[model samples]
Target: MNTIEHRLMELEAKVAFQDETIEILNDEIKVHQQQMAKIKRQTELLAEKLKESQSSQPMMSNMPEPPPPHY
Candidate 1:
């Protein structure tokens, strides 16, 4: 093949490889975004449960503790 034709073929190959890499990276990003969304939802649910548990519990008194025996 001629030098120009060979160079053009090489460039096309590089471009094809780059396109494949971009598609793989895009798929990975989509998976990561879905995972992040699930994690965020779980975190919010846990926070709500924590708040509910805290609210349902009784409050502590401000009274001082008595001294132990054998002072």
Candidate 2:
């Protein structure tokens, strides 16, 4: 075969390897995205629970008190 034909065959092999590597990377990215979504949901739930607790509790520091004689 000519030098050009040999070079073309080598380039084709390199391209095929790169394509396979890209496919594997894409699959890993998808898995990471799923994990991130689950974490986001859990974080939102925790925030809601925190809000509920804050609202349901009384502010003991703000209670009324009797006036002092100096008042």
Candidate 3:
């Protein structure tokens, strides 16, 4: 092959490799995005549950202190 043709083939191969790499990276990004969304939803649910639990509990300050073991 002529020098110009050989150079063009080499550039084309490089471009193909880059395209493959970009596709792989894009797929990974999609998976990460899905996982992040799921984690965010779970965190929000947990926060809500924690809030409910805290609200249901009585304030400890209002309760009388128990007698010491000396009784």
Candidate 4:
């Protein structure tokens, strides 16, 4: 092939390789986003449950400690 044609082919090959890599990276980003969303939702649910449990239980720090059984 002529020099110009060979250079063009080389450029095309590089572009094709870059396009494939970009596509792979984009797919991985989508998966990570989905996982992050799921984790966020789970964390929110756990926080809500913790809040509910705390609200339902009465604070009892004022209660006296019982004497040790050894005494």
lDDT by residue (1-71, candidate 1, tens digit) is: 69999999999999999999999999999999999999999999999999999788865454566778877
Model 2 Cα displacement at 2 (Å)? 2.5
Sorted on TM-score, best first, the list reads 4, 3, 1, 2
TM-score of 4: 0.87
Q: What is the C-alpha lDDT of each candidate?
A: 0.93, 0.96, 0.97, 0.95
Summarize candidate 2's per-residue lDDT along 1-71 as a digit string, tens digits. Answer: 69999999999999999999999999999999999999999999999999999889987668887789898
Measured on C-alpha atoms, candidate 4 has an lDDT of 0.95
How well does candidate 1 score on lDDT at residue 2? 100
Question: Which regions of candidate 3 fall more than 4 Å away from where they truly are?
Answer: 67-71
Q: What is the lDDT of residue 71 in candidate 4?
A: 96
Would you estimate the TM-scores of all the predictions?
A: 0.81, 0.78, 0.85, 0.87
Pick the winner on TM-score between candidates 1 and 3.
3
After superposition, candidate 2 runs with Cα above 4 Å error: 63-71
Checking candidate 3 for backbone clashes, the offending pairs are none
In candidate 4, what are the lDDT values of residues 1-71, reduced to their tens digit? 69999999999999999999999999999999999999999999999999999888875666787989999
Candidate 4: regions farther than 4 A off = none
Error of 1 at 54 (Å): 0.6
Clashes of each: 0, 0, 0, 0
